[model samples]
Every structure is written in structure tokens, then in C-alpha cells.
Target chain A: MKQNLFSPITESMYYILLSLSEPLHGYGIIKKVEEMSQGRLKLAPGTLYGALTNLENNKLIISVGVDPENIRRKLYKITDSGVDLIQIEIKRLEELLRNGKKVYYD
Target chain B: MISQHKLFFAWNEDKEMDYLQKMARKGYIFHHTNFFNYYFEEKEPESINYAADFKGFDKMPEEEYLQLFEDAGWTMVCRYGAWYYFKNMDMDALLYNDYHSVQNKYKKLLLFLLIVGLPLYYQLFIFLPRMSNEALTGFLFGFRLFVYFIVILHFSATLKIFKLYLKFSKNIHE
Candidate 1:
């Protein structure tokens, strides 16, 4: 299987990609990521905006809709590629934990 | 209302931000900043968080851009195209959480500056020299020099912005 270049996503990118599983506006992603991470990963607006642009450009996410209250608030949702990338990342992390646990118990 | 005006140096956002914060500490709140002038109005002093993001190269819609910052609790003070100014009451609030995105902001500014410089660069070689003639050339020698000076200034800004972009990019992790 050909590996995706973005398989080893950073923790921030992981949360952001995961957050995009549901349709969310820019602010919604920030709020959702913070909530999901239990305030452990707070995204600043500017950073989150940049990442969203990059992710969209890479075809991992798509602008799905706009907010009713604000014309400028575009909502984003992850694509199948993004979901696949995150799945690979999760398995990578799981394997890492398995290896570390094996070593610790030995 | 008396508005303080000053031209800040290119690539020196820290000094510019410091000046704004100092003004805020002394009862002045910044209202607008174009490329060359910063306009401020006096107000009651309080501890405030100030930040700026260069968004001219943004691929997203403008409404989406500002709303994100608003959601993050930053109040937009003023904007001039690419330059966005914001303030927050929280001391820890920042415009960027990651160094990569911070670099992206500067890179966008650099791209805009480069675009601004290109026409000036082209004009320096294309149109300005074409205006020179014997009698007119001698009479407008000083005018030509002044135009050249402005073009050079544009080039300098372009260079400084590129330098800032590289400075931010160097520390950014993949």
C-alpha cells in the first residue's frame, strides 16, 4: 500500500482533522477541539484559520456551508482522505503504545 | 480628537506592538493603521492584549476571517486590507498557537509586500527612465531621483518583509 505523506500528523493537525468530521465553522473547530481535548489543545483563531486553508488546499477538508448569522463564517467538513489519514495516525499511535508497554513490562 | 501618528519600521512588529501597548498603558487606544500611519485616540488605561495578523494572502472569505478571531474572544480594532488588529482582555490570548501558522501569517505579508514591490521595480526600469529627455531630463533630474528613492524604499520594505518571513519560518516545525 502506498503511504500518504500526511499519515504522521501532528497532534494539533490530528485534532483539527478530527474536528472536521462534523460540519463546523472556523470558530466551531476551535471550540470543539478545546472541548474534545478537555482544554488540553486550544487553537488560536489565526492558526486555526491557516491550518484550515492548508487542509482544504490539500483536499483533506472541504468548505461545506456558511453560517446563517454570519456570511463570512464558512463551515468545513473532512473528506474521505482526511478520515483515512487520521485512522492511520491512530494506528501508528496505538502501535507506539504497544511497543512502549511491551518494553516497560519486560 | 488628537490622533498620534507615526510610521513604524518594516519587519519590526515587536517594536510597533510595544509602542501600541505603551500608548494603551498611558490612556491611548489605537484605532487605525495604514501602511505608513498609526492613528490612536486617548482612552482610560487598562491592561490589554494586542495582536495583529497579516491576512492579505488568505484564501478564505473575509467574513470568515474576522469571525474566527471574534470567536476566539479577540475584538477587532481596525483593519487595512491584509493587516488585522485585535485586542483581548486576557493576558494569554495570542493570534497564533503554532509557529507554523505564525510563519504563514508573515509569509502572506511577505507575498503582499513582494507584489507591491514588483510594480515599483518594473516601473523603475520601464516607465520612469522613458520620461527622460535632454532639456526635460536635466530639469527633472531631481524628480527622477525622487521617484527612484520611492522605488528603493519599496524594495527595502519587500526585503524586510521577506526577512521577517524567513525569520518566522526558520523556527517552524513541520
Candidate 2:
């Protein structure tokens, strides 16, 4: 994985990483992101494709193989590095939330 | 099939998409484009969302690039040069969701124009001034004029794409 990738990734990138808890194809990832975000984040095809390529290049995600149901579609899953990045992001978010709450109560 | 001659500007390709969508609504479904003509076949009038992506078929296999769009419910209409045309029945479907990706597309286009156009312009400017009156007035002069016209077109196209790149760059923050 790139050293500076998770220095606070984009919301789309975070959602995409979270959606890959299971192996999914391009369109499946879009649906998964929408579902995870409660239909608030609908990824466009081009955006998802570009992001997938970037993630794969950075070794954050890896394509397993073609989807059996649809031969034209390829399935992708997050790497261990991806999971580690997500954990770091969650910790960072929690720290921010704790700081915000402290300010709110003061 | 009926063919209509039309000129599409690269920087404002939304106009081309709009034109294609309008034709689809008028029972003239766009088939493909050749040279400066757009060919359309008669079909039932239907509302379609047409999108134009300015990308060359060099980086990845065309099949793989197209499959992604196809899986996302887009139908590939045709590819003219560096432009890929797609259509979908859903009007809300977009090819690009974020400003960054859109800006990157324009940036790539601008870079390509500069790489290809700058050398041609430089060569033209350097060679034109040294040509003697004898060569300037000969049959080659017509060819020279054609070259000048082409260079002018190329310059304008580069200028327009550069402007679009600047506009999209500003929009990335929003």
C-alpha cells in the first residue's frame, strides 16, 4: 500500500474500502456502498472504475477472478493492508468525535 | 439510416450528448459517427441519457473498459477517435460522480493536445518564415494554407480544453 494513502482518504474511498468486506464486482461494490451509506452515496460507474484501478495499483485491493454468474465482470476484494488502513481511519474518527464532544460539553 | 453532418467541440461535449439525446427523442437513434457526420437509424421515439467520455483506448483493453460501463447499465453506442459514447435509459445515471474524476479527464485531454499540437505548431512557425516567394506561390502554398487552417483548428481546440481544465480544477473543491 502507498505510505500516504490513508492520511485521511476521500469519503468515496473509505466507503469503497468498507464495501469490500466481501468479494464483489464493480457494480456490486456500487450497490454495496449505497446500501452501507443508507442510499446516500450512489457511486457512478466511471468514478468507481477509476477508484478501483487506483486502489488495485496501490495494492489496497486485488482482483480475485471473473464473476461466475457474469463472466464479463471481475470480482475484487480488499487486502490486509486495506483492513489495517480502515482500522486506523476508525481510530482517527473516534478521536475526532471525542474531541468534538469535549468541546460541546465545555 | 440517415446521416447528418455536424461539428462537435471537444471542450463542450455536453452539447454533443444533448444533441444525441434530442435525436433519440425524435425517433432518430444515433448509430455511429464517421468523419464529421453522425449516422442515425429510425426507431421508436424514446428518452435516453447520452454521455461522452474523452478517453483514448490505449491504457486498458477496450473490452474491459467497456464492460465496467455495461455492468453499470450503460450501453456503448460508438467510439469516435478518443471519445466513447454511451447511453442509458435512466436519466439520473452519470458516468462520473465526483468533480476530481471529471477534472482529471479534462487534464488528460489538455496534456494530449499539448503533446501532439505543440510540436506541429512549432514546426509550422519555424518552417513557414523561411520559405521563399517561389515556394510560397507554388502548388505547395495551397497545402501550406491547409496546414495553417489545421493548426488554427488545433490551437483553438487546445485553448478550449485548457479553459475547461481550469474550470474543472476550481470546481474540484466544491
Q: For this target, which candidate reaches the highest DockQ against the unseen true structure?
A: 1
Lowest lDDT sum, 10 consecutive residues, model 1 chain B, at B131-140
Relative to the true structure, how large is the alpha-carbon lDDT of every model? Answer: 0.81, 0.83
Q: For residues B68-108, what per-residue lDDT tens digits would candidate 1 score against the true structure?
A: 88988998999877678899989788888877777777777
* TM-score between model 1 and native: 0.86
Residue lDDT tens for model 2, B1-174: 999999888877888889999999999999999787999999999999999876642354566678889988888999887788899999999999887777767776877888788767875987766774767676879878977898999989988888877777775342
Clashing residue pairs in candidate 1 (N, C-alpha, C atoms within 3 angstroms)? A72-B64
Residue pairs with clashing backbones, model 2: none
How well does chain A score by TM in each candidate? 0.91, 0.89
